[model samples]
Target chain A: MTFATRFRKSIEYQVVEELSRSVRWDANRIVVNTDAERLAGVCEALAKAGGIFDSAVLSSPASTRVPQVCYAFRMPDLGLGVSVFARGKNITCLSTRLDAAAWDERKIKDLAGVQLDGLEDARPLLAHPESGWGDFAEAVSKNRQTVLKPSEAYASREYAMEGTGADGEFEIPVGPVHAGIIEPGHFRFFVGGEDIHRMETRMFYLHRGLERQAVGRHVQRILPLIEQVSGDESVANAVAFAQAVEDLEGIRVPERAESLRLVLLELERIYSHLADLGGMATDVGFYASSSQFLLLREEMMRQNAALSGDRFLRGVVSIGGVDRNATQENLDATADALASFSKAFDELESMTLSSSTFLDRVFTTGKVSAFVADELALVGPVARASGKSCDLRRHFPYGAYKKRAVCESMAASGDVLARFNVKANEVKESARLIRSEINQMPSGPTHTGEKRTGHGFGWGWCEAPRGSCSIFVRTDKGRISRLSIRTASFRNWRGLERAVNGNIIPDFPLINKSFNLSYAGTDL
Target chain B: MHELSALLRAPRTDEISEEATDPAIRKVAALLRRRSGGVFSRSIHVRMVDAGSSNDVEVEEGLMNAPQVDCERFGIHFVASPRHADVLLVSGPVTLNMRRALEKTYAAMAEPRAVVAAGDGACTGGLFKHSYAVYKSGRVDEVVPVSVHVPGNPPSPYDLVAGILQAGLALDKKEAAKSGKS
Candidate 1:
């Protein structure tokens, strides 16, 4: 074994020896049960061992047992996941030491009714004050329907954002409904004239209680709901959830299905990134380039509809493997389409890059320093643009990625231009990956028709178009007892806040587009 | 210059033939064009409110602006504010948190405005209907008067355009009813 693998094994041994009540080792994960008091220490030790904080999930309360909280960390070097679970109503907060755990802890507090002893930001995360429903945690625990009072006068809740108190500072509150065709999110900008002094975003206006809705549902039935987590990220999220269920059942996906999935994923990434690239151009008032990008994106969406019967590419990924295999003719057609697409995309890229006006607007605008990116644990293109190599495809290879290495695309500037370059390059890279995956075209049965009945839990993760999307699922007799999803948007929203600080208000939308974090995914 | 030559070589429009266009979109466009001659002067301003959707509806709405569908060609424009809008295109089974916001947006619109509930979630609360977080059925009609329902997992851009045009007809009827009452 390599040194990093040996070091991680040693840390795992130490954690099991010192903190765990019982240890269960699966293929790519280690689940350790520990006390609530020791939760913070376990997380701290894992962090010291160079583990990246992935997500924190809260399981539903059983009749005789309290809800359990599982904190998952990614040991990228070893390609192993460490999940430390503690069953309790009160758990020690790791947010005091780990800034990345702040949002996860707050979400647990809101949904699970759990109290983290030292969580500083006590404001509600998912449950809004103006929602008019009683305490969400109470409603969830009691399994009671939310009582509606439409007669109650409409009221907007106040979000506290202390201004810089400089001579000309004032706050500009923008959306729960924006001026554009986008999801609803409220942005608070404290500005001194045109330049932004501080920026705070209050999201979760789109929370549909997806996790609570998953309870008592069969594992197979939940894929549709998981796909709803984010529209553009349907395949990635579905694949992640399916992988988790597959892990729980210990079913190996057929090699052909794995290759096909890689194709589908790369296609999704291509179209999704096209939208972002187009949006960035639109924000900068460069319609010439934006139109070309959108045109290509439209063609890509049509191609997706042809491959899978859905425009958004939903219902393709199932528990054991993919739902249907693509015929070689279809694969060849897609490869041909990709050839022309690459040509058009290259011209568009050069056209946008060569434009001095476009460059002037995007270059050095909305910069996220490497330190801020690391502190916030940003993922996907956002982290890669900031010089932090956090691509899950490289670090924790899964599915077809284990066989084929990804050519990493990154930039150190972390500006809007750097993000544009990274995302644009990623689209090209995705097209390349798709073409090669099709060329290799593994021929076999696409699924291992295994029974999914089981009583177990497992972690599933995928590098979504935005970033790494990780899901945690626990099943009882093939029914989902508990489900929690931590999308890349949840990890990277804070990075947007940091990127907007000191930048002008007009550039806010540009920066926001550059990150392109999913409000629905984050809210869910 | 290479840039100048590339710009010249680029096609100005996609120029998709009517036969290649989705029949649903063509039918809606024809209906909208005919209706414009009577009441609307061929223009309808719409403001979209995402009360609570998975955002598939939002993506379709954006696509409606793309060159292929080009809802603007049928005199439909997405305005910045509800005050300027002639219709409120709302997607939901409206979440409780967004209920007030949705209502506020509807109230902000001018008179004779129609609402189009786009997507399965908006019309019938689709998958999230049983969830506690949303209003009854997560249906837009539960919160607002939906003049038309365009239901798909998310209604495609063509269906969305059709629904909006149908909403325009509903708005014209509302206008006629109001003038008669006055």
Candidate 2:
């Protein structure tokens, strides 16, 4: 039998097995009620069959009062993802067996009120004690019933230290507000002089109920809102979400739209990654290098504005295809910009690598060990930095990525410098991909005007700048029934906690810049 | 860059000789003199909690150091936080998710406080008033009281400096007002 035939059969067998295991699997989704002990065995079985464990979301169904724990695992060979749902009896904690499952379980415990029976490290993930998890859950659940939807509750109740510390271990509380014009995230540092003993980050200060607001709204409307989730990564998230919806509906986007989508996605990646590289350089006082990056970033933003009308590419991508089709002139302008960006980036890259000060501060700082990275299941550059072989584009091909291979970037150092190097190289690669894709333009409509088939579940994802941004949609007869978007930040935020362990307090910003995760994306 | 050029081209008090001794200019100069201190001691940390606004150009241009009010001299830092802030500069109308963060930020500051409502959105809801995400229509003052209203799509950096200094003055007044009441 052919590989495709074998792959299809494997998926069918997996589905049947899940059905025989539990009656809850009747809905077509793989629902197995295995005990906590069997969780590792299930993961291993799926892994052996070329399945990649994506993310485990801690969510509550709008109707049911009980909390739901869903683990999303992807079978690359079959191009299928099965969401394994295990309800009742939170088996201690799953993190001990599956490292990536640890923090997600903690987050579930904090938000949906599930007790991870044997989970290690049971501290709150996004909320504080003063701001109880039940209160936030109630707020999120109530959003469904309100006229003016009450956004997800954003609060963190302070939790006192459990044990007594040595005298003079003063706490240095930084932000909800900070020194930079960034998002709101509170970092509590237990410091003895400048050395940091423990660093705890409390965010969600600006949790706009993005999912709640998206509830019941047409798929088209949510694209613009998703773009606005983070000012910088608007296009990446939108494309990822749209791809997910399209996958579920089984709608084939026009060849032209798919090609253009690839072009825009790459452009977005280049600009966003450039900003990060520039910001990292600036943070370490490399002004000459930083200034050059700023200039490049400005050029890209102007090109984006001229081509799409909005600098950030907001309101661009839609469900069927893109909202605005790019003319030949716009396409030419973009190609020209990519060429110039390539030449200029070469100079900046050389300067950044050659600079001793830049290398010293960024290298060997903010390290997340290989074992820790596996357990936490970090995504994007963070996951790759720690020598973890993972990339959504390579693991699960979607859009133009499936047709045209992505030259995946990875680093073993797992330091700030390693992240910088990986991103810098990726930026060049993105430019190269954009140039090549545009050169071989496809001829067709940018979108399919047909109505969506709403009786099935759709899943889609894109390799976002921060990490893999995955979206799941369940449509009930042409309307969105349930939607869940697990951004890269949500999965990688825990990696930041682990990275900051041995570093000094002052080095926090540099370490953070390395990961460069979005607070708004995670909070939502 | 075009927006930056547009801001640079605008006439400042230095360009207008007749307004050298004007009260507004005097107020501006007086404010500028005391603006040496910023949100952070090591850096001039300017934390902008943009409520919600459509004028991103004006908002972006307002961040640059214009012909006047060289914030770099004062070591003023432009930050994204409100917790470690010495000043709270608000832009755009207060949106629902952002309302609590704004109010909590104002309350979190130590005693002396100053708030600058930059842009029409922060001063008035402007175009986003009809949107459901907006917390309070009209102004940020509706959600949390304001000390200075720096109105523009986004005010120029000079105007931003003027607003920041005004916030410092308000902080002084707040301390004095507390003393007088005591």
Candidate 3:
């Protein structure tokens, strides 16, 4: 059977004939707005047809009293997401049917005050109840929805969980204060001796409210903030944001710009993955391999800094094209650096593999079953490590990915070691892609000043170092009215929760570091 | 003792090998011995405040398991309270929510304290320069007297360590000037 036919049959979506009364608008993607009642039926049909819910965002309309909850769905092989907007009098939650919509519903309930009547676990997702949900209420009202009262913010959700368990089942609350030099994230594990019973993760410590702040401001001005969403994945976020804006304006980026974007994106991915490799080594106490990778990462960062003014590759990508262009000298220097760095990276990988201490800790530890990975809808190297072949670059190509085929990396075991292997493999692939992209730079105007109107809906997806970052831009006239960005972190945080189950508390750092999902990305 | 000194001087990548006799490692060994002479005794108590920047949350929690910039290894202790602190670690572009938090933390600190602003967001609001939520258009120095600027998107732990050491050196200079006056 054909992949498409098999996929369609796997998820049973009723192929409905287009009704004459249905209002359809085609711009960036196909859009058909149906009443809230029809939305559930469509979702069921789409689910039956193997269309997965990519992301769902709920925001109360500024002028209307009724809430507007949007569900974004993607059919894997098709590379398309159809957003269904559901509105009603205190609408019923889709989380009941689709397990993925659970968190989305909680976020809606927290910010827009949308009461999802049948939500299974309607815990306050973004706000602290002790501080009062005032900023959340004010956010919905003022259209300034990002910044909430300090007491009721995303960071306040973490604290020591209180409870007693069976004999020898003592609770170990590890962080939101860690021992290493990494981002802040708290984990509470209910442990019996060495084995874990239940583990809960608390991320979002570095929420900058970039989403709330971006509203009302010119979309062009907000690209830099998007780049800073997480310091490491700046290029990916910038490209994703630019692609979204470009799609909305119905403009095609120049060929040279696209090639340069791909090159920079690959370079960015190289440095990011290098750090992850080094971090994984560090976690296993392999200082020799760790330091080697660290020094390599530092060298790459310096090269990147020379190519782009910012060390983190921030503020270089604009809405239409990149802010700066790489000269031939710059491309040549990067090519030369990658050639030598690849040798060093290979040696580091071998040294790490040979190290008994490193392998012992990561091999069978933090095993996330393929079944659980699919259930949680994991992405990036984490899911790839487990034999689930999901790469946004392969599935839905945007930017240079459409032209140049991506070398998708995967490992069968969803353990720390598998994640390490996937990341190591990706480093080589990213370098190969970067060298090719740099070699084939086309000459043309770097940017197109296409007018942005708040008239339609646009969506963009890019494979960030962590995973796939999807952006949905909803425009009012030519300016953005609403934007919902689901970073790689948002989709993959649940996998960490599952990966930690049955593992000892100390092994958490190694497992978490392997994933390296951005706290800022998820929080925002 | 001199033999131990000679051993320290060997150039090494993996570890300080007994038989290795490289010139570069020899030079490093000499440097280490000279520096290690005094037991590296010093501690600087620091009280960190987010200083109203978006960075307030991170500073309040002490930068996720990042080793407390232990100058005491070179000799320094990061104090929890301002009354005992000799240095103030401030992170922010200086936001409206954190303006009062900054002043209160600074006011509570004991005298002869040095302030080190530790991020691009804190050093200069970076991209968040024109927001209404921000109080100052520039660095933390504009609002609070800053002695050191450790700049990065978020500076590495080593950069942070280097900044704190710079602050300690500045403290020594201030102490010398005070003693000279006395």
Consecutive 10-residue window with the lowest summed lDDT within model 1 chain A: A147-156
Number of the top TM-score candidate: 1
* lDDT per residue as tens, model 1, A1-524: 89555764786558754886877777777777899988988888887887889988885433324668999988776678889999888899989988998999999998888889988898888777666666677776655556455554343565466777888789899999999999999998899889998888999999888888888888988899999999999999999998899888888999999998999999999999998999999999988788778888878888999888889999989889898889888999999999999998988898899999999999999999999987777899999999989888998888999999898789999999999999999999999999999999889989888875978787899999999999988899999888899999999999998999889988999999999989999998
Query: What are the RMSD figures for all models against the true structure?
Result: 2.2, 7.4, 7.1
> What fraction of the true interface contacts does model 2 reproduce?
0.12
Q: Residue-wise lDDT of candidate 1 within B1-182, one digit each (tens)?
A: 54467566645443434453677756674765557655765788999999888888898898887776777877899999999999899988788778888989999987878899988889888888888788777889988888999889888888888888888888778877888899
Instruction: Kindly indicate the candidate among 1 and 3 with the higher DockQ.
Output: 1
Docking quality (DockQ) for each candidate:
0.66, 0.15, 0.11
lDDT of 3: 0.68
Ranking by lDDT: 1, 3, 2
Cα deviation of A345, candidate 2, in Å: 1.3
Task: List model 2 lDDT by residue over B64-159, tens digit each.
Answer: 432243365544556545556667777655555456667777786655656778877678765444444456463788877788888754354556
DockQ of 1: 0.66
Writing each residue's lDDT as its tens digit, candidate 2 over A266-367 gives: 877887787678779878987767656766776676688788877667777888887789888888888998887798798679878888888889889989
Please give the interface root mean square deviation for model 3, in Å. 7.9
In what order do the candidates fall by TM-score, top score first? Answer: 1, 3, 2
Off by over 4 Å in 3: A1-11, A15-32, A37-41, A59-65, A130-135, A143-165, A452-454, B1-90, B93-115, B123-162, B170-182
Candidate 2, residue A429: the lDDT equals: 84
Where does the lowest 10-residue lDDT sum fall in candidate 2 chain B?
A: B54-63
Residue-by-residue lDDT tens digits, candidate 3, B82-152: 78888887776664434544666678777677999988888887666554345445368867899998776
